[model samples]
Target: MNSIGRAPNDQTADGGLLGLSQRLPPSNAAAEQALLGALLANNKAYERVAEFLIPEHFIDPIHGRIFQAIVRRIEAGQLADAITLRGEFEHSGLLDEVGGTAYLAQLLTAMVGIINAGEYGRAIHDAWIRRQLIDVGETVVNNAFGRDPELDGTKQIEAAEETLFKLATEKGQDGGFVTFERALTDAISVAEKAFHRTGAVSGLTTGLRDLDKKTGGLHPSDLLILAGRPAMGKTALATKIAFGAARSLLVQGRETGTMPRGSVAFFSLEMSAEQLATRLLSEESRVSGERIRRGEIGQKEFDRFVQVSRELQALPLHIDDTPAISLSAMRTRCRRLARTKGLSLVVVDYLQLMRPAVGTKPDNRVLEISMITQGLKAIAKELDVPVLALSQLSRQVESREDKRPQLSDLRESGSIEQDADAVMFVYRDEYYLQQRMPKDTMFDSADKFHVAMEAWQHKMELAHNKAELLLEKQRHGPTGKIDLFFEGEFTRFADLDTVHGV
Candidate 1:
């Protein structure tokens, strides 16, 4: 393995200076032989390790072939004893390559019993994992030594992280079918939690009353799309949800003493971390972010901002404001946060700005968006956290008479609708109506202008401080519009006053 990507030295032909034995990667040859023997001795023993062990897990190539033959025969509804495999190998003219029929008998001698097959298989797999780790280390070293000039220092680090994440999560056999009884147990557990919890929410509560009642809650392993046209307050709503979830997590932790606020990862592609922080502060303090930025706020408002900022200093919300962050890098960062701090939710501020995994480039924008959404869903499932990704609606929404975004308005990508567990649109009728306000200069008469102005004012009054969250496509629940209170000045969203009417 160490000699893999480079030319062999002069001593390589004669077993190398390091010697063939020393150069070999970590492997348990006896364990491999024992596992194969157990499989050949009792075909039922294969089930003990079938979930994790494969043919390549064997140290010896001959053993791999024998294991493969056994698997094929067993899967074909035929007995896979040593004699049957030998006959199959003989007919295939590959008996000699596997040390003829003698090796089969030797493997039987190597086996102590079929009862230990699972243990032996695990040993072999552990050795293979170690070998893979060594290979990854070598690649990292080789790349660090300038093996790939195109990859800069940071890109190399990201690439290494990507490789390690894949290895850690997807390598070997970590997933398989679950028994029906066990699955039922898990389902019952979820139901029990829902019964005990407020509003029957078995998942993370988003802290929005109507939204929680409508959708239950932000569920784990769910990829939710929060999309809208420009000026629709998508970012504001996403931030609100993140803040709510973080607060809920913190309160729960304090009550149970189990955690310190479930961590939230906000990947802000368009805005810097400070900018996002300011937006949150503006929402909390009821001071306009623009006013704060322009130094237009009074001393009282500024003091309120400072106090709110200090109070929010302990929220487990982390922001990664790297623009055009690739999916691999995002996954790596999220994994790091999950490992160190414990992640509960992820928010990507607009997915269109995100790039796919490094080294992958789609030929068209649509495909790229598809890849990004799929990656987001994958991350949601991998991390067992809800991912709230903001997206841009297509320009076609502007041409519509109602101006309320539908599922088709999700930009150019159909995959966003397809991949998302829930697709929500942030639509503010006030935003569109403000654009249609009649100007006196465009009117021919004062009476006409007054009529237009009055009509516009009536519409504005109705839509003022109101935002509709259109839950268009919910895989597990109903779809409808939920009105929320939106303050454009502070860019904040909250539950509407249902008792007083929205």
Candidate 2:
């Protein structure tokens, strides 16, 4: 038998299976050399890969240093050839380390063609990615072997995910400066879209008419904070917006006869996916969520509920109900969704329920919240999608006579307010007015009690079914209150009309 056909236990002259284990990590030395040669031959080739290919992507240290030196000279508008680079290295007393001028000249011969620079650069970058993945795998294995005692199984998984995410995004193509002319062209395109679309909305529709008019719809790359106290319908309003975005995507897809380019992602940290679906069903079917849960619906209502659910199933909306989800996990999931389904919007039910990236130990609650908010904003910018994160108001909003929420009322106000592009509060006067009903026992006379009760009833009638959306901080536009119709039974929100019940 040949030595190549030896058994697993066999230690032949070639070292058998052990030799395979000792293989070098992924790398492309020739590709690196070709890319460097292309750049040294013609500096214009640098522009082709400058956005994504960094010097660190090279396999050999000498190649990396040469690329870096070339980059410096080219960026400074100077010639970067074998002679220029050698002078640079000699001046820095590193010519011997970089194989001297002879090596620089040899790189010139290594070039296949300058036109293939982009391809060669990409190959080097791909090798670098593979190398990074191998390193990540090694770290994960080491951690699993109890290298990090503080990291439990779940935390180790989170750490691994975070590391991979960092690797994927650190040199991603999502960032770069846009020329003013290009930016202006994009702005004009948005304006043109608004001019042709109904309601003049240049962004994704929130399904609320007044809100759409005020904010020009839920814009991409914006971090909008929707804040309110308990029982104020923060989740309901956020769900409404998410559902609205999904419905819009569906309509566009139907019009075009192809899948829409994007979908909505709702991260319900406080509620289960089923519960959020129930609320959406209730809003659409005009049936109460509580009644649906209690099985109090009649045959007709059940039929309607099922029909609405079927229709909703066609919409491009996704829900994640992972309680206390870490920021990195949410980012990882969003990236997956964006890659697979094309993400348009992200809604975090409430930021307070979210934890920062695993392995981070914040010193205080404020710092923790700051990290969470900053991470959320980063996700929005990274994915180029809107992030509508729900927030809780501080108890201080209750101490005042007016229960309307202010920017200061935001829990962890400093970070939440500062990080958000816009801040809005959902306020329903009926909730507070109903609690202050006058009692006859507190009055000295029957007439006095009757008068107080009448005034209270009038106020209730005025506030009933009416909600206000206070746009407290809008970095892009004016801040004002938008009137909305709130259905308490179904937990639905719509544009309010004074003459008609909408």
Candidate 3:
């Protein structure tokens, strides 16, 4: 049998591959041979390319088997020269299929130098990547030709995009260890930036002073879960963060007379883009969005709204109001945004409404939620930006006497709690206390009812215009409650005055 596999369409007078140009995929057989030869000559050469290249990257099947055998022997604390590899292959009944001892000797002739092993391995890996791309293209074409009847055209597009993204990110075997010295250098850089910053905020600031002091701003590659029950200002809080980041980016750009690298991406799965914008306008103009919609604003208020809208037109905040968007679609859009305009933060307003990747039908709701959280975390890491995902709390919080949300109150708590780097709950005691006011009909006497009502009014007064951000889980910092002032009319949150001790 031929050592090089015979090509069916390349039969000629000498049975060579002169006419096999149209039949072969992209491959570098010579480079594979050179890399394997170097490995056989000196096992130390493997360290140069071990982080990026593997045996499957080889073009020839025999070469891949030989590389695997050599790796196995070397990793087992044995010398892996030509003689030892040949013996091991012979014992495993693979020597003859790998062109026997003669082919092994010929590889030594193919050896160029041990120093070039990394280059050769890279060449082989590049060819492998090309081959994979070809395969992906072919699969896309075949699926488009009615191979999968279950997927419609839009879903097929999502599937194709998902497959391409997977190959783009997960194809190469890269990123090994880093030295402790390099890590210390990064830490020192963060410290230096914090020292120079006005408020010592090391990461992206949330624009709330107490929250910034407690959390030190939003760090890159962090998955921060902002969760709460209904009517607890979860959407309002997320919108606040997105607005703050965008405003900061714009202000920094203007002050430095340079382009800013920070921008905000808000994914509003529940609300329309217009509604989100209106909320921001109301917060800035101190006018009620409900009244604006009802045309109850006077001339002065309308002019203020117009002026605030004009000012906010320059903020680099992008909103996507797509309902129930899948994770892959979000990733694709984020990547596109990052490519065209820089991205610093991503906000997904309510994670429960998001679907997993297309064509992934999990067996249960828990697994589906797990996949979605993992995807969100992966997006955070891949883009090297903070992802603030809003989540819903279970109704069990309503039954609790304290009404302060705990970690267990998170809807689909398992994956969400596990995957999040930090978990925060928005709690308003005023909301719960408002429901506890006693009525005249329920009390035995007017005096008793008035006493209960007075007690309830005092409790509401204590909790009014206040909201608590309970940090139940933080991977890198302390966990406690940070008080914030909430305006019910504007649906806005601000740093509470610490001197008065709210």
Model 2 weakest 10-residue run by lDDT:
15-24
lDDT of each: 0.88, 0.89, 0.87
Q: Write the per-residue lDDT of candidate 3 for residues 161-208, one digit (tens) a residue.
A: 656655665565455786788799999999998899989899998988
lDDT of 1 by residue, 380-447 (tens): 99888999999998889878788898887774785899999999998899988888999999999999
Instruction: Return the TM-score for each candidate structure.
Output: 0.75, 0.81, 0.73
Ranking by lDDT: 2, 1, 3
Q: RMSD to the native, candidate 1?
A: 6.1
Off by over 4 Å in 2: 1-21, 40-51, 68-101, 169-203, 219-222, 252-260, 294-298, 326-332, 335-342, 355-371, 378-384, 411-414, 439-454, 498-502
In candidate 3, the residue pairs with backbone N, CA or C atoms under 3 Å apart (3 or more residues apart, or in different chains) clash, namely none
lDDT of 3 at 346: 98
Badly placed stretches (over 4 Å) of model 3 are 1-173, 500-502
Of 1 and 3, the candidate ranking higher by TM-score: 1
Write down the TM-score for model 1. 0.75
**How many Å off is the CA of 144 in candidate 2?**
1.3
Candidate 3 CA-lDDT value: 0.87
Clashes by residue pair, model 1: none
